[model samples]
Target: MTDQPQGAPVRLTAFVHGQVQGVGFRWWTRARALELGLRGSATNLPGGRVQVVAEGPRAACEALLALLRGPGTPGSVTLVVEQFGAARGEAGFVER
Candidate 1:
């Protein structure tokens, strides 16, 4: 857990643009989300983008965001669009 007190759990939606669809971006996102103890799904959109929806403790979700946007990101992921909000209380993380 992070040092700061994150008031409540949250859900994070990220649209990773660029060459993100065919390069295992969804699976990578799922694995990382599950590893972080978050629950959500990663799906490939019609465009060359991957959408990651993660729900968990605020800090964990934030960590997921950092991972996708930082070094943990796949080589194909050039840009990441992130949105945060209240959690939907999902159960497990998966790839779709």
Candidate 2:
């Protein structure tokens, strides 16, 4: 479930903070993105932030952002910093 018949695709780069690391945040993002049929990657960044790059339909990406803002997981998410734009040729989702 990494892709679907969707509208004009887009991309979203997000920085999620607040107990993001060591709490399956990246894996959680991957699962959610797969469910949305999105393509991207979720990585751990410095300062305890999880960096996620998602590419898919605009609505799907936005939906992913919403969950990133408050997705239920092992840790509490307090913030999800993100920027949206046109897709940049990203493929399958990854965790790094």
Candidate 3:
């Protein structure tokens, strides 16, 4: 079987870098996450990094990571993706 986490929802955080800030990454993530039925938020950090927190099914959360690392808006390119450990039971995704 696949090594997916079971029982309860999975909380995930990803640090998206390179051409993320000011390129609609936050808005993209918020919309996508909501569409995928996940809860989290995306925001621009101080150092031109976009951070996203997503909590949902294992497959859905993993898919979000892929989207974050892939091509973003009109002028966005993902340089790297750094994923963190699991966190659970988030209220919802918000822009902060």
**Would you list the rank order by lDDT, best first?**
2, 1, 3
Clashing pairs in 1: none
Q: After superposition, how far is residue 62 of candidate 2 from its true place, in Å?
A: 1.0
Off by over 4 Å in 3: 1-7, 72-74
TM-score of 2: 0.88
lDDT of 3 at 9: 69
Give the Cα RMSD of candidate 1.
3.5
Per-residue error for 14 in candidate 2, Å, reads 0.8
lDDT of 3 at 23: 65
Scored against the true structure, residue 62 in model 2 reaches a CA lDDT of 86
Task: Choose the strongest candidate by lDDT.
Answer: 2
**All candidates: TM-score:** 0.86, 0.88, 0.81
Q: For residues 3-90, could you state the per-residue lDDT of candidate 3 as single tens digits?
A: 4467556778777767777766788889889989999788778988877899888778888877776655534664656554566578
Q: TM-score for model 3?
A: 0.81
RMSD of 3: 2.7
> Which pairs clash inside model 3?
40-93
Instruction: State how far residue 48 of model 2 sits from its true place (Å).
Output: 0.7
lDDT score, residue 52, model 1? 90
True-vs-predicted CA distance for residue 56, candidate 3, Å: 0.7
